[model samples]
Target: MATVTTLAPQAPQAATRAALRTALRVGWFAAAVFWTVLAVREGVHHGWPAATAALLFALAPDLALFVGLSEAPRTARGQLPPRAVPYYNAAHRALVPLALLAVHALAPLTWPPVLAALCGWLAHISYDRAFGYGPRTKEGFQRG
Candidate 1:
């Protein structure tokens, strides 16, 4: 006797969720490009200080890794210490820099360096999200 087997179909909910995730990733990548362009434009127009600020702020988010150095026992390989999760999440959130940019725009004196910093920060956040990296859980692992 011959037996025929059919592949299991993915659930509708799962397919919808997957499509939404892909859409979000695409949006993030587009935001990354937008922020990067703004950062480079400000940096080039405003000279070294703006450029320097952009470079430094772009890398500043990962500096949260130092937050729990003294509480080393809570950390493990490929994970952050529980103490650092809050700091990491705060640093990685796009809202923080967005707020800063709004404030800068409304301030009496707008500074190119501040604009560069905000753009750089947003670019970093956007790129991370675009590449599937996001805030950690309270237990310090990447959220699913």
Candidate 2:
């Protein structure tokens, strides 16, 4: 009797960077879905103005970050350098959450709007944390 020999499939090793990136992607996607659902629900129950306000405020930080990153310095190859630019970008991300928290503390916001903003901020934190992008992390923001 002849027996067939088969090679066992190998399990992929987890790389810290890749795992972090994947987590960030998943968190961002979840945040987007959550935002859409909250917006729709608020619009249906409350009104367009309230929903619009929530959506806009929730997205403000992300928009600001995008603009800031766009104008950030780049290397000769037209790519953001790994060290300075990335640190700057991470600082930019950290600022969004801090700004949101400040607004929440200083200004009075209705529960729905406040909740929406908080959720958005949490999403941003998750994205940053996943990619090792925060003040405490090695690759993230740091005090000078």
Candidate 3:
């Protein structure tokens, strides 16, 4: 029942924050392509096992925005409680994976699987951001 002051908070109520269904589908396809390319590249260099592990991190974070128990907010329509908006934004943020990358770069871990997973997160976020899907507003709408 919570709602943001705006359509998605970042824009006015009249803004076209909702993407058309067809556009959503196409955006998904683009995301898949983005994931595939990165996964493939990781597989080629690190082997399938690493790629497999990497896949674990791939869509999970982004998916977390939309997943909730019956009483929780539904991110699909950006209908989460106003207080929960920050959680969705955190899930959609690139800070964690980027931080991992920075740490890896500075520390140079020998673990390929960990690095691969980090890459997957980066790739997934990249895909979503690339196609205009971003953190949801409390009003259950995206700024697309």
Candidate 4:
């Protein structure tokens, strides 16, 4: 005969929601500063429309994310579920380019939108990863 012992499993701890939020805030600030500097330089080179469009397009994705996330329940802030994030992220990522592609086709294919979209996508990934909301783990909030 052998004696058996088992330890109770630990409860799931809350995700590092605050850290994720901080990261997003900081990331956006940094991106903003970077874009401002780049815009000033581009404006000097290419003039106002180029610079304005660059900044606007760069901010579009973050703005879209903010709008969507703001509508979520208060409890769902930093812990947005992976399933929902991809949808929001995908839409945010696709919006400007898709619109550009639809409207002018070739004009928006230039550098500014592409660069801004890339920055936005990177920001989205960083925000999600900061909150531990990757595809493999169901660590964040879930929508019914």
Candidate 5:
């Protein structure tokens, strides 16, 4: 009788990485829920203008898609346009809206609609992160 042997799979690292990725996604999802609740609360407290602002700001970042639709050349179909990469990245960063919120906290005046907008923006970014969407590379492709 002949005996055959096979090498062990080297999937531990891969498994670990996948687990971490899942944990990160869950964290982002939790943040999304928190921010969404806050946004809704702000809009409810402040009325129609704030609600409208929140709704608009939530969808604003995605408007970057329109840039890809323009005449600018792309590396592939459905890829973001190079011209729009900067705009999309900037809008998607959680830090921008966070900084705005911090500024709002410190500034002398109160703007309810702006606060609502910031909350909406944070919710949008958090949801994107949760779904594994993020800033694209300069080449207009998803970064690894």
Candidate 6:
């Protein structure tokens, strides 16, 4: 005889997944708000260049994940191999942008390209956090 089943009874693992998804959503929203406010404030003070720079810098890094993963080896389960996680995470982590922002703030770098690039990096990283994209775990899973 055939058996019938339904999604009505979610497994324990499903609950965990759901919880993680909710947490990630909340985090993403908060990050987005923070970055948006910061970007707006900076744009107000620094002019359009700040926003433009940030958008450019923020997008470039995420591209690395797409580009990097294409080259990374996949596991039997079709997941990213653990070895490749850090490299993906490094590109996505906000630390780089955070540091750049700090350096720029503490002492205004006079080099136009560098300063703008840093600002852009800040914008990108912050937005990445907001967009529910966090760093990769050693298991090759996303922190988000």
Output the number of the TM-score-best candidate. 5
Report the lDDT tens digits of candidate 1 across residue range 7-66: 777798799999999999999999999999999999999999999999999999999989
- How far residue 61's Cα lies from its native spot in candidate 4, in Å, is 1.6
The residue ranges of model 2 lying beyond 4 angstroms of the native Cα positions read: 1-20, 63-111, 116-144
TM-score of each: 0.87, 0.41, 0.60, 0.37, 0.88, 0.54
Model 1's TM-score against the true structure? 0.87
Selected candidate, larger lDDT, 3 vs 5: 5
Pick the winner on TM-score between candidates 1 and 6: 1
Which residue pairs clash within candidate 2?
none
Clashing pairs in 1: none
What is the per-residue lDDT of model 3 for residues 1-144, given as tens digits with 9 covering 90 to 100? 997684446555335434454566576667657656766677678897778867877867755544444536334543665555676677667788778778887884567777778777767776777666778766646765
Q: lDDT per residue, candidate 4, 82-129, as tens digits? A: 445555555444344446444544563565444444443444444444
Query: What's the lDDT for residue 31 in model 1?
Result: 99
lDDT of 2 by residue, 74-120 (tens): 43333333344444454446456557656766776555555454554
**Top-lDDT candidate index:** 1
TM-score of 5: 0.88
State how far residue 125 of model 4 sits from its true place (Å). Answer: 7.8
lDDT per model vs. reference? 0.93, 0.52, 0.68, 0.49, 0.89, 0.62
Model 6, 97-126: lDDT tens per residue? 678667767874453444555555555665
Model 1: how far is 29 from its true place, Å? 0.7
Report how far off residue 128 is in candidate 4 (Å). Answer: 9.9
CA RMSD for every model? 4.5, 8.8, 10.0, 8.5, 3.7, 7.4
